[model samples]
Target: MTPSAIILIVLGLAAIGYVLGRQRALKTAQREGVKLHSLSGYHGQSVALFIAVPALFLLAAWLFLQPVLIESSVSGRIPQSAIPEGGARSLVMFDVRRIAEGLNQIVAGGDVSENDLADMRADVTDVRARLAEVGVALGSDVSPIVLQTAKEYRATDLTASFVRNIAVLVVALGFGAWALARIRPGLRARNISETFIKALLMGSSLVAILTTVGIVGSLLFESISFFNMYPAKEFFLSTTWNPQFRGGSELGILPLLWGTLYVSFVALALAVPLGLMIAIYLAEYAGSRLRSYAKPAIEVLAGIPTIVYGLFALITVGPFLRDWIAQPLGLGSSSSSVMTAGLVMGIMLIPFISSLSDDIINSVPQAMRDGSYGLGATKSETIKQVILPAALPGIVGAFLLAASRAIGETMIVVMGAGASAQLDLNPFEAMTTITVKIVSQLTGDTEFASPETLVAFALGLTLFVFTLGLNILALYIVRKYREQYE
Candidate 1:
């Protein structure tokens, strides 16, 4: 508690001191007789920033590095005879921590000791007592080199903290003084700030760009390996999709692609109208009270973990759909089928599509609806004619996004969609999706250097390309339509 409070106080003082100092610096820079190149506020900001940044960075570094330095020094002090070579460093560090803790425990409770426990206990007490002293002896004689290393490390750390604090003060005073002297009528404070902000934005964007490049590079290398094993034509054109490499297996994609498309289409068919209607009702018809109660209820679906949804689809929804809906309509088998996975996926997508569509529908100008109303148009007529047309492009954008989400969905399909890649139109029959196959290929005992494992990369590349294209299209339509309306 004492250490924590001290740290908190130091941090609080630094921040408050920076802000107050900055304000004073600004006032000093803005004085009548001062010759300045930058604004008074900029000079103040420079002072405050310097006062805060360097000292805070030093404090953070010390807090982290101190523990590691102490541990390493203690490990070096432990004799080679006490602990062996390979495990020596780790054992010394562990025992160092335990030895101190055990002595603290001994102070509280006189516990039984192992061999040489009294000596170990004394050593711990000595180390703790000497820890604060600049170059004090550890009563039990350690090697001269170890003692010198510990002393040097402590001195270096103290020196670093002192220098860092000085640097902070110097930077704060120097920047404040410089900015005060530089301030003038022609200074461009806003442009300088904007340039700094732009550099930060570019740095952030580079992180994302690098991550995307890495993913693409990984997929490209694996896909190239896969293409070399089996001809690209056979992979794309062959009707069969059995990926088992037991005896020089046949690797085809048509069956998997068919299953993927069938499940996606089924999900879209279930999701689109239901999601659209809910969006319309929420946006145009629902009272504010009802919307407040209902909107979050619908969104709650999104928050439910995907694993739970997968279980629900497997244990509850799948059986229910199979027995009640599919079996009744003579469409699907007992539990696992394309319809089960698709229906569950559709339920998952409803909140996503409805939420986006509702926002777009609401964004259609109220004046457009008013004009239609002024022409003696009914609520339904106004919505059907004026509102829907205006919001259509955005709605399309939302649907495309939902489609991409459904395509990429893994858990529900893995649990409910059967692991059989078959080229059949029967909705009741079991089917496998690209994601399920990817999981199957990679999981359990599997060789990395095989065409079977590599196929997952090819599928991943396809999925990435497809989603990328969809996103680009959606963004273009949304942007163009937004411009039109604006």
Candidate 2:
């Protein structure tokens, strides 16, 4: 049975147990002529928790383990000679899995029986033609060893899936019966249900923590592999960014880092003042109807996909800057320039900063404004001296967040800021950021094990660290200033 089917079945059983448990609790209370300690719903919840939770846990654990076990078991059966030239065992395994799935499809379509599939040999039978008929195209005809390995892969996987379904049902029935038997007037059903709920909440919380750890671990592992192939110092400190698939590439980060910072600086320079002014006007000066209409309209920019923004930069913004400003100044004639990307990105960031700052500014006590007025200060003076200081930390945090967003942007940079990794001071000159190069370096016609491809991971790790640092600094500032205000 499929995992979804098993889940639905278990839930069905849990629903039945809920009805049974609730009815049983009410019967026991009425038969004993005593009041129940908890509500009937709590009794039903305790039974349902037992029926579903353990069964779901087992299903999840089995799903995670089954693939690893199957892969290990099947990998050992294929000989080293079966692996293609310049390819790892992993690549062969991918083919083996595809073949296995194709065989399953063939059986399901009644093109082959279970016995016929088991008895078939690639050398004696037209396995490739049969698989192809089912839309599983292979690059080459099936070899005997791969066919046998694929057969083994299918057998083990099917067995594991079958066992998983049976085990989940048994667990659901067993745990559910055990819980229902213990349901009585003094069973503390409410506490048991709450404890189970708390445990689920804790698991949900761990998912985020575990997810962060997994991301860091994967980046670190791939980065370590990259550093082993390329020097760490060269990657971090060198002044160029060039990757040649044929080896001896100048994989420097200085130029990319400079462009990232330059573009981000330009973006922030445009966004921060404009966004803050918009936020201040909206929060303090705009009427309620205007604020409601205007805030959502400004925030609508956030809903537009980055690719759409990229198209805008490419078609509209890039040409405008190149013709009007860059060409006139004799800076550069390229449509793709840092100034074009920065301006578009700043427009993208405006909503992020303005929304957050608006909330923070509005959160300031109105009594502070009244106190300034009582002290005979003008409106502008009150805002300049009292309100802005109180809201500064949060505003700074919003800027940092917007800066991270700008730094990580890929499409706008690619469309507006041309893919030239250079350290020029002119904003009209074509330049690129780390993210744009990371995409370009890792994409297409490259070996995964090669330094060029692995360098993407290193770039990603660096970006993650930089963004993480920004987040930490923002959190620290917010915490420190918030405590003072509170």
Candidate 3:
């Protein structure tokens, strides 16, 4: 049976056990002529947890370990000479897995009978041509060693899956019966359920923490490799950004960082005031009817994909800015410029700031506004003095969030702002951000041994630090102000 089907069967038995456990609890209480200690459902839930949790954990562990064990067992069977020049042993194993899976597909379709497959030989059956008929493409003729190893891989995996199914079912049923036998009226089923829930919550929290740690560790590892190949000081200090795959390429973060900051600054310059005012008008002045229609309309901008925004900037805004403003003013006449991407990105960020600030402003107490009115302050004055101060922490967080988004933007910067790394301050001049440069450096057929390719990781790590700092500062400000208000 399939692993998924086996899991479903185990769960079905557990569900039956729950019903029996609940009935048993009720019967024991009635027979003893006493009130139950806890609800009948808790007793049933305890039985279900005992039945399902251990078995499900086993299933998960089996699934995780099965591939590793199969790879180890199968790869050891092939001769070391089977690996081609400039290729890894793992690459040969990859082909083994693909071929094994493809052969299974053919057998399942009845194109190859079980008896024929058991007696098959690559030399006699023309294995490559047969595999092709089954839609499995191979680069070259299948070798005898590879075919034999693939057949073993398929058989071993099948046997292991069968064993796993039996083991899981046995554990599920065994623990389920034991739990049912232990279900007395005085059993602390409620406490058991609560403990189970708490452990599940902790496991979920750890998954998130582990995910962050894993990301940082990968970046740090690759960045270290990059630094070993290229000097760390020059990577950070040199002003030019030229990457030559041949060798001795001038790779520096300064120009990309400058362009990123410059574009972000222009974005914030346009976004902050407009988004803030929109939030203010929606939260403070607009009626419920107007806000209902307007808020969703504005939020619709956030739903539109960034690629669409890039297209808008490339076709509409870039040309409009270059022809009318840049050329007319004798500034740089490039259609793709810092100004074009910044303006488009700012428009994209408007909904984020406006939505967040609106919520923060609405959270301010009515009593504070009333107190300001009692002091003969006008509505605008009350909003500025009483409401804004209270919402300042959340507002600052909103702005920082927008800034992170702008710094990390790729599509708009790639298409709207041309891919030239420059430290110039002129907004009309073409420039590229850290993200765009990362894409450019990593694209196409390349070897990871070169500094040209590895430098992308160094660039990524630096960008990660900058955005992480922005988020941390934003959170700190929000917490400090919240504590002060409370």
Candidate 4:
């Protein structure tokens, strides 16, 4: 049975349990002529939770574990010779799994009978061609041994799926019947239901925490592997950014880091002041009608995708900067440069800063403004001295968020700033950031074992650490000044 079908069946059982449990509780209360410990709805909810939660948990665990067990069993049968030179066993298993899925598709399509599929050999039949007929394209021709292993894998997976469906249904039905039987006037059904809900909420929070840990853990492990193959000192300290797939590449990160900072610095310098001023006007001076229309109009830029901004940079802004400013001043000739990307990204960041700062400024108490006014300060002075200081922490937060967005931006950098990693100080010169290099390094056919590909993870880890540091600094600034303001 399919997972969706199993879920539907479990839900049906839970619904039935709820109805029966509620009826039983009501009947018991009427017959005994006593007040029920919990309401009929709570009894129903308790029954539903008992029926659904454990069964769903079991189903999720089974689905996750089945692949690991099946792969372990099937991959053991694959000989070392079957793994191509310079290829890992995992890649071979990947092909085996794909072949298995393709075979299943063929059987489901009714082009091939199960008996015939079991008897067929890779040598006797064009397995790849058959799979292709069902829209499963293989990278290479399948070997006989690999084909046999895939068949076994399919058989094992089907059996496991069948068992999983049966086990889940049985658990759901058994628990549901047990809960229904326990329904009575004295049962603390509300307590049980509430406890289960609390547990579910806690589980959701843990899932989020674990997900973050998993991402960081994966990056750290791969980065360690990359550092083992490449010198850490050269990667961190040297001022070159070149990667040769053939070998002996100078994978220094300094140039990429410099470009990232330079572009982000330009973007933030453009965005922060304009955005803050816009926010101040909207929050402090603009009439209601003007604020309503203008705020949304300005915010529409935030809704625009970064790729669209990149295209705008490439087609419009880049050329204009090159021809009007760079050519006239003899700065540089290239359309794709750090200045082009930074200006476009800065434009993209405007709405983010303005909207956030506007909200933060408006959140300041009106009494503070009144107090400043009563103290004989003018409107502008009150805003500058009272409102702005009160809103500074949140404004700093908005700036940090915008800075992070600018740093991580890829499409704008790719289209506006050409992918030439260098440490040039000129904004008109073509340059690239770590994000662009990470994408380039991982693009196309890649071997994860090589330093060239693994370097992407190292770059990712470095970016993560840099962003973390920014967050920490923002927190420190907020805490240090927040007391004085309060």
Candidate 5:
């Protein structure tokens, strides 16, 4: 049977099994004079999953193994003169499959050009005739034992998939029907389902924990390597930013730390006020018509790709700042300065702050707002004093999230921030960031053993630690503040 037919049969059988299972379960419950174990849909779903999951798993396993097993068997049949070594065997197998599929299409189809039709007709006829000739020739030229083994290998594979499909249908339907018939009042179906679901949930949770461990392990190893070359004190305390390419590289952490802080501060400086005002206007002041139209419009900012923001910083904001603000203020020579990337990144984060703050503000109970009004507070006064404080911790969380985003932002910094690792305080002057250095040191013909490449890992570790600390702090603040409100 074809693959598509197998799939349809499996699905159709599973669906029928589900319906029958649910009906049988309900009838058994009535006959036994006991309450149904679960909702009708859950009964149906339990049976459907029981039928479908094992069958699908079997099908998937067969599909994955079929290709590898077939390739190995086919590779053995091809003469040694055709190819040597397994290095090119995989590629040749792919081409052979395509050639066989193309021939099948030629034999099956009729609407072809006169020239192409003639060629395809000849090709299919020749292949079929050659295949038959090869079968007969193999029996004679090859040793009987070898010929028998080869034919058995090919024939077994041909029926293997068909057998698997049949097995899938029989096992799934038989087990699902038997299980459904056992679903009486005291069977603990819900408990069993919940246990399965809990396992799934636990499996998902492990992924997050494993990811964190991997990051920490990578950083811990690289930082240990870095400390072997540079002392821990200098890396943490030195103010200078220069890391020498040759022997003079001073691996200090202070300069990059300063740049990270400065850029994060600048982003917050731009994002906070605008985002807060937008939130306030949307939540407290805007009419229903305007609110309906405006919220998604603001959310559109979030969907603009970060690469677009990088280009905006490089091509638009960088040049404008250079031509407008930097020239007028006599700040620096380059337009792509600390401020350019920060400002662009700030724009990118506005949606994040506004949407989160808006949710928190809106979540402030209506009773609180009514109480403030009853006390004679104006609309703005209620929001400023009562609602704002109530939502402060959540807003602070949003701020920390935005700050983390700014600190970790890559494309904008790589394109817009200057590469000079400077300690200068001027926001208009050219400056480089930790992320930019990470990208630079790790890319472009890097040697894994060299300090230059290893330093990127160290920098990455620092960034991870910094972000983790911020998230922990945010959670603490939110928890403490939530207690007061509760």
Candidate 6:
């Protein structure tokens, strides 16, 4: 039976349990001539919760664990010789899973008999072609060991799925019957149902917390592995960034860090002033009619995909700067440069800063502005002396948020800034950031056992730390001054 079928059956049982439980509660109350602890509806809810929650939880756990346990058992049966040279066992298992799925599909389509499929051998039959006929594309011809393992995997998975469906239904029926038997005037059904709902809410909250812990743990563990293979001091301090798959690579963070900071600095320089001006005009000076139209139009930039901005930087801005400005002035000739990426990234960040700053400026109390004006201050003076100071903390937060966005951007850097990792001071010369190298290092048929590939995790950890620091600083600034303003 399918999981969906099991779920439907469980739900049907829950519905029946609800009706019976409610009736039992009502009859007991009437017959005993006593006040019920909870409403009939609460008794019904308690029955449904008992029937559904534990069964569903068991079903979810089984679905998650079955493949993991089956894969572990099946993978253990495959000989080490079956794995290709310098290739992972995981890759072989991937192929095994694919072939198993394909065989299942072929059987389901009625193109192959179960007995015939079981008797087939990789050496005797064209396994790849047979799978392809059913729309499963294998990369290469299957070997005998892989074929046998796939069959085993398929059989094991099918048996597990059948058992899972049976177990889930049995659990649902068992819990439901017990709940119905316990239904009475003094059952306190409302308390039991409410407790289950509260536990569910807590579980929901823990999902996000657990997810964050998992990400950090994975990065930390992989980074430690990388640091063991490569010197941590050199990774952090060396100025060059180069990685060769064949070994003797210089994996450095300084060049990437410099490029990231340089581009972000250039971007913030352009975005901050312009966005602040826009925010000031919109919040303090612009007419309501103009503000309504102008604000959304400006914010439209935020909705545009970063890839679009990257393409814009690549096709238009990069060439324009290279031809008209860089070549004429002899600053640099390359189209893909720090300046190109920085400018385009700045344009992308404008809406973020402007929108946030506008809200922050608008949030400043009117009394502050009135006090400045009453003290013989002009409108501009009131804005500079009163409103700006009041909104400073939030405006700082907006700037940091824009900085974080700029630091993490990948596509814009890839398209606008050429992948040359160096410490050159020239803005027009191409350079790459940590994110770009992280992508490049992890791409293609790379082995995770090597320091070169594992370095991606180290780079990722560094980026995470840097961004986390920025967030912390933003929070600190906000908290330090927020109370004074409030």
Cα lDDT tens digits for candidate 2, 31-149: 98888999988999999999999999999989999999899988988898998897799988988999999999999998679999999999999888988999999888889999999
Per-residue accuracy of model 1 over 299-394 as CA lDDT, tens digit each:
998888777878988998788878888789888666888888888888888998899999999989888998999999999999898999999999
Q: Would you estimate the TM-scores of all the predictions?
A: 0.67, 0.96, 0.93, 0.94, 0.66, 0.94
Give the Å error, residue 353, model 2: 1.5
- The TM-score between candidate 3 and the true structure equals 0.93
Candidate 5: 10-residue stretch with minimal lDDT: 136-145
How high is the CA lDDT of each candidate model? 0.72, 0.91, 0.91, 0.92, 0.75, 0.92
lDDT per residue for candidate 4 within 183-224, as digits (tens), equals 889999999999999999999999999999999999999999
Better of 2 and 3 by TM-score: 2
Runs of candidate 3 exceeding 4 Å displacement: 27-36, 111-115
Deviating ranges (above 4 Å) for candidate 5: 1-190, 243-248, 482-486
Kindly report which residue stretches of model 1 are placed more than 4 angstroms away from their true locations once superposed: 1-33, 39-194, 245-247, 325-334
lDDT of 6 at 127: 95
Reference-based TM-score, model 2:
0.96
User: lDDT score, residue 467, model 2?
Assistant: 90
Better of 3 and 6 by TM-score: 6
Ordering by lDDT: 6, 4, 2, 3, 5, 1
Better of 2 and 3 by lDDT: 2
